[model samples]
Structures are given as C-alpha cells and as structure tokens.
Target: MAPRILLCGDVMGCLNQLFKRVSSVNKSAGPFDALFCVGQFFPESSDQLDEFMDYIEGRAQVPLPTYFIGDYGFGAPKVLLTASKEPANCGFKMDGLKVCENLYWLKGSGKFSLLGLSIAYLSGRQSSDVQQYGVYSQDDVDALRAVAEEPGIVDLFLTNEWPSGVTNRANASDVPAGLSDSMGSDSTVAELVGEIRPRYHISGTKGIYYAREPYSNIEAVHVTRFIGLASVGNKDKQKFIHAISPTPASTMSSTEIATKTTNTTLSPYTFVEKGSSPKDTTKRSSDSVSDSQYWRYDVSQKRQRHGAGDGDKLCFKFLSSGSCPRGQKCNFRHDFDAREQYIRGVCFDFLNKGKCERGPDCSFKHSLQHEGENYADRRPRSENSSSKRSKECWFCLSSPNVELHLITSIGENYYCALAKGPVVEDHVLLIPVEHLPNTLSPSAEHEVELSKFQNSLRMYYKSQGKQVIFFEWVSKRSSHANLQVVPIPSSKAALVEKIFSLAAEKLGFKFVAKKFDSDSDGRKFLRAQFDGNSSLFYVELPGSTILLHQIEDNEKFPSQFGREVVSGLLNIADKADWRNCKYSKVEETKMVEDFKSRFQEFDPNC
Candidate 1:
C-alpha cells in the first residue's frame, strides 16, 4: 500500500494553528505518515513568535514527523541557530535535519525516500538575496538538476515556487484571465519538473490551490500532476492542504523508475561523443554493415526508383559512395565543394556567387565562417567522415548502413519502413527523403507527399478496423525528421485526442489542436501555425487532431517521446524501452516481408 501524505502550503509561523488543523484533518484522514509544509514556515508577525519558540526550546513538542521548508521567520534565526549546533543538524545534508523531536527541515535541495516514496525538494523561495528565508539560489537549482538527470521516477516533487505559466493552463474562476506569471513561479522550476517528470508536483506561497491534469513530459514516459496550495490560516479558507498516495514505482515502466545502483554509466541514446572518428569515404566501410553502427531503435532504408531526381540535381552517391554507374553520362554535379555545399544545405546560387534572393525561407544553411576559425580543423564528424551522420541517423535515407530489409514502401518525397523494435506488427515510420531538421521544416512539396502517405495509412487502418496515429518530436537543432505511424484498436481511436489533451493539462499546460478541412488542402496552416517556439508536432486520429508544443530552453526533450506514449496507450508500457522489443535481423526481415505483402493495397506508392 502506498503511504498517505498530507501537504500544506505556507504556514507563516502559525505552527500551533497549522498542527491543530493537521490534527483535526488527520482524525478521520487515517494513518498519515508525514506532513510536508511549503512556503513560509516561519512566523510572519511577532504575535506567533513566542509560540513558535516554544517548540524549539522543548517547552512544546511536534505532533508528527513534520517537514517544513520556510526556515526564515521571526525567531527563526535564533531558534534554528541552536538546532544547527546539534550533532544531528550538522553539515549541508538536504535531509536529516533535526529541528525538533518530530520536526524536520528540508534545507536547500536534495532527494530522499520517505515511506517508500522518492521525494525531491527545492526549498526556499525565488530570490537573489542570500539571507531571505524563502530565497532559492542557483546552487540549489544546479544540485536539483543533477538529481533530475538520473534515469528514474520521482514520486513527489516539492517546490516553494510555482512553475511559470501554470495559471494560464486551465480555465478557473479563481485564476484571473491574464494573471501575470506568479512572482513565486519559476521557469527553471518548470524545466526541472519537465525533466524529472515527477508523478506529483506540489508547490506553495501563491495562496491558491490548483490541481492540474497529468501532463506528458518530453523526456519522461510518465505524466506529472501539478498542485498549488493556498496560504495556511488565511481567512478565506482557500485550500491550504492536500493529500495523496503515490502509485508504486513497480506499476510504471522500468525506464520510468530509478533504481538504487551506483552505476552512473551513460547510454548511447542520450550521449553525443565529441572529436572525430576514423573512417574512409573511399568506399562504404565494413563497419557500416556491422550491427555495431546502429544505436537503439535506429531504422533507415531507401527504395529509390529510377529517374526520380531532376537531371540538374546533385547525386549523393557519386560524391559519397566512391563510385557512380553513369560515369560521364551522370547529369549530377560531382564536385566535392558542390556536394559539401549541398550537404550543408547552402543555396546553390549563394555558393556559386555568394548571394541568395529567397532570404530566410530558402531552407538552406545561411552562415558565414568567421575569420581565424579553421573550417577544415573544426569540421564536424559528419563532414570529416562522409557516412557518420547517416550511419547514425536512423532517418537518413542516404545511409546504406540502415535497416535495409525493413523498407515497406516508397513515395515521391517520403517512404515507409518498419520500426526497428515495434510493439505492434504493423508499426512503421514515415520519413522524409531529404535530411530536413525536423517535421516542422518540411517544404510545400514534402508536406503534400506526407499528407498523401498519411491519408493512405488512415484509410487503410480504418478499413482494417484500426486507427492510425502520426507523432514526431521536432528538435531545435539538426535531426532527420520522421513521423511515427502507429495503428491502434478502433475502439480506443476515439479517445486518443481527449486522452492526450487531458494528459497535457496535467503538466499545467494544454496542447493547441487544429483540424484541417481536408487532408490535401492544408497548405498555409502549418507554415505560420508552428513558429520558432514549437518543438513537438503530431497528427492523431489520422489527418486530424494536429498538436504541437513550444519547448523552453531548459526543457529535456526525449528522442523517443512519441513511442513512449504509444507504449502506454497500448498497455504494454514495460516494452516501452525499445531494447525489449528488439528482434533478430532474420525475424525483422521476415516481419518486413509480411507487412509489405499485407500493405500492398494501401501502399500509396504501390
């Protein structure tokens, strides 16, 4: 059974009243293990000073295993000074502070287990002043971020400040329209909460109780619930206290739970190695054919038909593949500089004469090399090693080092391939033929082909009594784009949009949704609909229910965020880790052949 915890916000040194209230509530509340108090635990006025000092001086005793965050109030410095002298209160431990017999103070930031629940906290308020009781420092944020980076689940997260933009998420009568971001709200807090993706996010000091819906974070498989509490002892009786028992970590995916091992090893999925690697572009390296080149869940292959590219277009094979079949008859540019310029996405005219008339929307790399910077010396691994990015980029079609036999179908600008590790037999990836940074950057022609591919899959899935879903995580930096095409049971298809919106709202935000009048006519909607701020993009329930999220600078965006959602929706979350779903190459090949035969009628390219 999960432990029941009582959460209160901003006691304001009203310990006598706070405990009295806690006791009254606990009478029927039944076996509450701990009471966590946020906001100002110190007395705001002199009237409560004498009574607050009584507990510190041993004249009175705390009733339960009470934990408080606000440590700066009238009589706090003097009283806490004495407690600091005790052996138990020594050092900078985030936990284990002996404020009184049953009282504990969560100083600074740290994580600890309480009643089998993992609790993380950043105590104190947002302030630059070092001496302020509620003042949270950069050091605290830094320490908390380190904890959040670990692979696991935090059952409960406590903060003195609310996450920024939380109030704008839900429509509540108490939350005034256009209420300025709360003074007690911190964007850093929101970023960390997004990174940690805790089950429950609790905060106080704003004096309002807002229980938000569970939101799916970018990096984490689970959704987080944000709850803000009102100031204790406030006359309006605004809800100052909340209670909840967390679901056991065992119930969650292993990828979502943190273990107690000392191993701090990094996985290739999250880590990017620096420096150049030895490779020969003279010919396709034997390493490319080896399975060692593949990262977790990497999948790519091409079904290039004859006479596809324009006669004037550049041939990537002649430039990087070390050989060309057409030889003198090849109509493509074979110059190294021309190919490199193309790879960098520089406008061809700009490369030729150093000028481009199309401006920013030209969809080309537009940057000048600064003087004194050695372009050759600082060339990225992708440039130095011709196949490096393609070899590793699962969505790069030019890479011969892809899951070759997995290609299902090929369209004009897009193609379909089996997911490297699929939960469902029909799971597939619809990827762009070009190395566009993300889904949001697709050009008009690319969008048209993509829509056709989606429509074909949607129609086919409906005929099969299933629903198709398309989702992708759009990165701010360069990454080959692909949309996850998953087919869910028809019964649950109707619930996908509502379930996602409800989930997004839990993290104190909402997913802005739009529906196109028709699958083919959606030309201008996305060119401006998704601007610079947007990071996540998806198409649910076929070509409808388009959703996007604007990412923050500090947000932790997961590479496999969309797949994690599908895993949960299918109720096989344990297999959410792609590693668990891996099959032998032979098995994968056979599976591909089976899917190809079955997908013939619905294959748009076919």
Candidate 2:
C-alpha cells in the first residue's frame, strides 16, 4: 500500500486556527503517516517560537518529521536536512526547519514521498532575481522531477507561490503581484506538476479555492482561506475568518465537510496508518529542544604530562570568525577559506598535535576554550644526522665566571641552552642541546617551548641593566644549524672575545677571526639586533665542527671543505662570503700566521 502524506502550506499566523479546525473536523482522524509543513512561522520572540514547536511535535504523538522551507536570516537556510559524520552545532535533527532557503524531501510509508520546494520571491526584476529570494530555481525543479520519477513512488509538491499552471485564481491578492499573474502565464502550477508529475500539488497563493477532483494520476488541490479563525470547528463545519480572532465561530455548522474531493484517489492507509518514529524522540523530549546534539559541555580533571608542568590547567578556545585581533590587515577575512585549508594541511603533516588536518587537531574538548591559541605552539622537529660531535671547551669548564641556564627541556633527546660567555658580562649564547642537523624543524613540543623561551629571554634582557642585541649564524656545509648570540652591555663584547681567545690558546687551537661592522656587507649577518648601547654578535655554527687553525689557510682539507665552510657561515649571517679555509690543517695554520704577521707589521702600537 502507498503511504499517505499530509502536505500543508506556510503556517504563518494560522497555526492556532488550523489546529482548532483539525480538532473539530476529525475527532477520530487517524495519525498522519507523515506531516510536512512547507514553511512554519513563529512569533519574533524566541520563547514563543520554542513553545509553539514543542507543543506541535508533542501533540503529533508520532515520530512524524517536520521540515521548513524558507529563508530565516544570514541569507541561508538554517535547518539540517541530511545527516553528517562529524556534525557541527548548526547540524542537528528536529531543530525545526528554522530559516530554510532551499528544497527539502521526506519519504514516508512505502508509496508516498513529500517534496517541498521554497519558491523564491519575484521582485519584478529579471527572472534571475529569484536568487535574492533565497529559494530554489528552475534547475531545482528539474532535479526534483528526476528524483520523483521513480515508479510507484507518489510525490507531493508544496510551496508558498502558486506554481505555473492551475485554473483556480480565487485569492490572487494573497500572492505577490509579480508571482500571481505572471507565474500562470509563463509556467502554470499544472505545467510544473506535469514536469515533475507529482501525485499531489498543494498550493497557497491565489484566493480561497479548491479542486473538486484529482487530475491525471496526481491530485491537484487548492485551499484558499484554508487557515483562518472561522475555519476552527467540528467534524462537519468550517467558517472563513481572520486568524487573529480568539473567539470561535458561533454560526459555523458542525457537519459541513471542509475537505473537498475530486478524481484523485486517497491511499488506503491515509486515514489509518501513523507516521514513522523520530530519530531522536527520547533525547529531544528529555532535553531542551533548542539544545544541539552536536554541541557538548563538560568539565574533566586535567594533568600535565611532559610539555607543561604537572596539574597545570590548559585552557583552549576555538573561534569561528573575528575572534583574533585584526591588526592593520585583518587576518580573519570571510575569504580565508584557502588560508584555513593551508593551516589544516600543515597540521596534518605532523601526527603529534592531535592528528587534526587543521592546526592543533584540537579534537579533544578542553575546559578552557579560546581562539588563536592552538596555533600558538608550532615548530618543526630536527632530523637525525651522522656527523661527529664537537668536544666541549676546556676553558668554559674551568672558568668560574660562566653561567649556564637551562631554558627548557624539550622531550627526551633534546634540551635548550642559554650560555653566558665567561669574559662577557651580559653576553649570552642560545643553543639547542640536541645534536640534530637543523633547529629550524624541531619537534612539536620543542616548537612550543622555543616560543615560550624566546618570550622569557626578551623579558629577561629588558629587565637587566644592559640592552640585548640578538644574532644567529648557520653553516652551509653540515646540515646548517643556528647559533643565537645576544650581546649585553657592561663590557660584555670585550670579555667574550677574551674568553674565546683564551679558550683557543689553552686548547692548543688557533683563532680564525673575521671582522663584521655596520659598514661591511657582513653586517647583513645579523638576525635580530636590539638598539641598546651594548654590541651583540650572533654567529651561526655549522653542523660539522672544524678545528679553528685548519680554517685559516687554503690547503689540503676535507672534500670541498673550504667552500662548504664559507658558504655555510655566509648563509647563516645572510651575507656574501669573501674568505676561505686552507685545504689542510697544517697549511691553514701557516696562512693564519702569515696574516697575523702582516697585521703586526702594519700596527707598531701593538
């Protein structure tokens, strides 16, 4: 047997009138297998709307699905017509077709299918003006027909506008002028039905009218004044009156038949079988109807494991739009769809940060939620290398003036360092304890820790008596790593140079020196220099350590070693290279002696 579906037009202010009418007409009317409301209107007050929707659903008693088709605000439909895997708050079942601006479909029983298409308002402009109506277009009609063409599946079309084709024009004024007269002329409701060939067509535009019989295999019905204060009555009688009246109609007969009949055949179960159950009947009834299933709120105990200290509460927030501070250029543009995609891709590249395709997978719900914090801690991890490690400086070990501060412990294999040069009072060198090839790409945890440490260093320098000058250098040959050096005032530069020179002498190594000044091209080597009175020198060290004396002369050295060293150092300083090392350590030492010999001859003051 085909399923029986009840299709109704916009409820507007006629809900009360219709409800009373239905109660009086069918005292024993069987529950509808499916109840579809083309567009339901509620009062401006959210409370009233909530109450009305709740009462309607509760009274229906069946899991009968209700849908809306129209535009609410926000220029888009606000109802969930289909299911989603990871649904957002906006996606939920039974939220009541809030502000729908599209077509909807619901299949009931075994035979009947209810299809609702919202007719876009005609503004008397071009036909394409329907786009502003926030409703379906001609293409949508074609799509509906394709779906409804299935055999044995009865289709019912309901809309606010009187579709193209239909002889009745009772309440033409009820419909907008552009739609009323022109719709029938261009494409009547009957023609549209012929196109889709639905089993039923219920429209509400023209004056009060009804078709006495069914047309073709499909039923074409019209109801003018179907909803009004006068229509509220008993099984046999109905009156035509305004919907705002509170009093019942006194003159209305109790036995007059309100439903007109024609050639269309009613399904055997139309007056018997009830509709299907709702997907979330229990949840919806127990919880607030406005409560979204996709949204959850809970408080849980949290404990820090490695990155942060123990028992520290990590508060995270997710903002949809306009959450972050927009400086001169607003980063939060509606057109950031591409940027969002890029962030998601980069986040997926690393697996540790919650496995999100977006930045900071943030899948888990944290107590504290905020926007722009997830991407706060982003850093690349270093890959392993096979180069030999350099020996520790003996002078640094023996000097009592040196201070070592452990900024952060980045995971099991790596640590960050803040080393104070012995002779240099406020001079500090920031280095990673990890023997990795590049610090540019640190582990996820390290990335976060690095940022935090940098912030702390900035604060520390500002608090001290001397200003801080920061610099970083890298080597080209060995997988280049950065060496961060911050020079502080109070004779720190001279002191650092003295310690470095003394360390080389004690270690039986020769000092390979290069002078960089503001005028020299080497000045470009500075990474981030502060404007304090103190001078700072930041040097990037090569991943592969070399003997200082071996770098002085161009002699027999490691394979392509001289070019590699010069290139690496120049790269770190962001400058052009002018000096090269010798091919051999012995010859390089000789060259260093000769260079120093010429310097001494030029300056007798020494």
Candidate 3:
C-alpha cells in the first residue's frame, strides 16, 4: 500500500477551524501519513496572532504531522526567528524543522524523501528585494534546480504561488471560478516546474480550487498534475484539502510510471515572448510563414546592401524584417550585429539594476563584447560563444511569433507540432527547441529523445493503418531545422522510395541509399558522408533504408521536394503546396487538440 497523505491550502491563521476540519477528516480517513499546507500559513492581522501562537507554543496541539510553507503572515517573522535559534533548527536543513509538537515549518527551497516519496518544495513567493524570512531568492531557485537534476522523479512539489500561464490549454469551465489564467502567477515558479517535472505540483494563494487535468512535462517520462487548493475556510465552501495515496516512482515499473490519462495536454509553460501582440502570433498566412523560414538569409542580404558605416548602427526594424520602409533613405545603418542578434536584445534587468537576477540563465544579452568593461570583465569569455535563438525567429519556442496553438509536445532539446499550412492531415514537424541549422548530426542525448519521438510517431501512425516517412532538407541558408514526418497509406508505402527517386532524377540529382539499424548509426553514416558545414538532404523509410543526398554549392534543388514526393505518394499532389492546404486558426486549433488527444497514448514523455 502507498502512503496516504492530506494536502491543504491557505490556513490564514484560522488554527482552530483548520484543526477542527483536520480532526474530522482524520476520523473518517483515519491513519493518513501527514498533512501539508501551502499559502499564507500565518495570520494577516495581529488579532488572530494569539490563536496562531497557541499552536506554536503547545497550548493547543496540532492534530497530525502538519508541515507548511507561506511563512509570511503577521506573526511569521517572530515565530521563525525563535525557531531558528533552537539547537535542532541549526544549519542548512532541507527537511522541515519542528517548531512545536506535531508542527513543522518548511523554510526556503529543498528536496527530501519522506515515507519513500521524493518531495521537492519552494517555500515562498518570488521577490526581487534581498531575501528575508518570508521571500524566496534566486539562490533558492538555483538550489532546487541542482536537486531536480538528481536521480529519480519527484513525487510532489509544493509552492505558494501558482505558475504563470497554468491555464493556457485548460478549458474555461475547468479553471477556477474567479481566477484568471495568469493572475498572481509567478514565471519563476513556472520555469522551475518545467525543469523539475514533478508528478504533482500543489500550490495556493489564489483562494480558488482548481484541479487541472494532468499535463505532460518536457524531457520527462512522467506527467504532472497541478492542484491549487482554495483558502482553508471560505464563504464559497470550495475544496481546500485533497487526499492521495501514491506509490513512489522508485517502486513502480517503467511501464506503470509512464501511464497517462486520456486528457493529458501539452505543458502549459510555453516560452512566451514579452510585448508581442496577438495579431503577430496568429498570422498563419503561407507567405508570412514561408518568408520567416529564411529570415537569416534576409538579414544577411540587408547587411550586404547597406554597409555599416563609422557613425551608423543597424536598424532594429530592418534586422527583424527583411525590408525596412525607409529603404535607402534611412539615417541609421541597415546592418545587424551578428553576435548580438542571437541573444535577442540587451537584458533590461541588467541594464536597469547593474545586475540581473537570472544571471547566466537570462536569455538576453548582458553587454557588448567591447562595451561595459566592468561587466565584461566579470562575464566568462565562453558565455558569448554559446548560441541562443532570438524572439524574432518564427520557429524558436521563445519567439512571440511562434504558433503556440499548433504545438503538441515539447522536450528538452526539441518539440513536435503540426506544420503551418500542412501538406496533409497529421503532417507533423519535429523541430529543435534551440536555434539550429540542421539535424544531420545531433548530440547523443538529443538523439535519444529524437529516437523516442520517432518511434512513438511510428507506432501512432502504424495504429492508424498507415506508414510514416521522415525527411529533412538541410538548407545552405542556415535556417531552423524542421524534420518533416508524414503519414501515407500502407498500400502506397512501396511507392514512397520510387517517387522520391523520380523527383530527385527530375531535379538532376541522385540519392545514395544506406542501411542502418538505428537513428544513431544513420547519423554517424551521415556525418561521415559529408562535412558538418555542407548542405544535405535525407529521407528515412520504413525498412531502415535512408536515401541521402549532398547538395553541391549553387545546386538548384526545389524547397518542396520532400513534400511534393510524399504528396504524390498519398495521391494528394494538389496539396503539395502548403499554401493550398491552409486552415483557419479555429480549424488549426481543433486539429492540434485532436492530434494531442489521439497521440497521448503513444506520447513517450507522458
């Protein structure tokens, strides 16, 4: 039997009411392991302090082994200070410290095992000011990240504030009654949840109970269920406590651990670019998506046309778009800074406060290599060597322009989504989460996740009585990689190789066929076929046969070669051009939801 635990929401210093309800629940659901609380553990006013003090001072007994966060109410500082002075509460404790009999305070952020369940927690809401008793700091977040990197899955994660955008794909009816999707939600908490990938993320402080449908996590083999409890005692009588008896992940088999419910949705914490308008993201016109594909080439051409002068700098508008309205008449330079482009813009937090709380984790540029000598000296030289995607790139997950509604699944290094202006139904693209030019050769860990996605998709399509073909065109223009996965009727599976070869012959090129048992071996063969910098295209068929082609310099290859061949094999040549297959945003959203629902069973991360 698993450990039975009771989880509760905000107590708000109502010790008597909370205890009364706990005692009642304990009588009915007798012999539970422990009780955990989140949000406003202390009272807001001094009048209620006496009741809170009674429990802490042992005048009134706590009913069960109760632990709590949200240590920031009226009497929190004095009580915590007194506890810290005790010998048992001394140094760097991750687990709770006993303040009184049956009562414990979980301070800061840490992870510990109790009753065979691995639990991780962040004790307070995010704060910008220096860390004190009630607020959590950057150190706490970093500390948890280190713990999250350790071995097995975390069974439960406790936090005070709700993660930002927690209701992104949730139904309006399923959301809490009075709470908005993003109100009072902290982005830092969201990031931590994404990284930690806990099985159950319990939070409070919103005063409305919401038991969200289980959500899939990026790069993890398990799903996370978020439950936000309401206040302990409220007029609406909303549920403030929940009971669960979960078997620890360590004891469960791999198959049992990966089980997912039918309603599992994609992770809600999609990287959203700040300050982007709704219109920018929802524009799914074929022309816009196509133009955005070669944005790097466009930037390069603009730089060539308007050379950077001694007194001029790059035009931000021109750099973002291929063309600026001013054209040749602009006063500023039209060239962009190649080094600064990848980091997006300067870090506003660093600029305003001489220091960024995110530090190395920030996605924005801190300072120019030649500018800010003091800051430059402090930064590691290798920090700038690593590449990151700009928000302007259409495929980058952090970009404001990304079509969030189309995304189905996200992993650590890659994500899967329906293609914009898809060639056919169930047309999916497996894209690198980072900004990368090609997928000819990926790292070992990346290859493992990529293979899992491929196998999952293969099984999914197989169940539909169809065969899947994967293809990618490594462009010389250095654009983002999108490995196209298309499904064809089983009857037409034999014709796939024939059609691709015919298309290649028509384009005055021939493919070299290679056999490999696994994706890793195929990648090794590809790396040996051509240098990493060369442009190439490849197709992986059902029988482990890969058709590889290395495009020579200035080779005239059609951009739609793979889609055209697959379209012909599926007898949908008219839909070969993605523009012809465009769907309305409403229809696209329905398509994504449908794919997510059907694919949940085969989702490896689920």
lDDT of 3 by residue, 353-373 (tens): 346666753435667444543
Model 2, 288-369: lDDT tens per residue? Answer: 2211110111122111224322112111111211111122222112212111222232221121232333222122232211
Off by over 4 Å in 1: 131-133, 170-180, 250-606
Order by lDDT, highest first = 3, 1, 2
Candidate 3 regions exceeding 4 Å error are 169-173, 271-606
TM-score of each: 0.44, 0.27, 0.49
Which portions of model 2 miss their true places by more than 4 Å? 1-5, 23-26, 39-134, 148-153, 168-190, 217-606
Model 3 lDDT-worst window of ten:
288-297
Question: Best to worst by TM-score, what's the order?
Answer: 3, 1, 2
Which is better, 1 or 3, measured by lDDT?
3
* Cα TM-score of candidate 2: 0.27
Q: Worst 10-residue stretch by lDDT in candidate 1?
A: 267-276
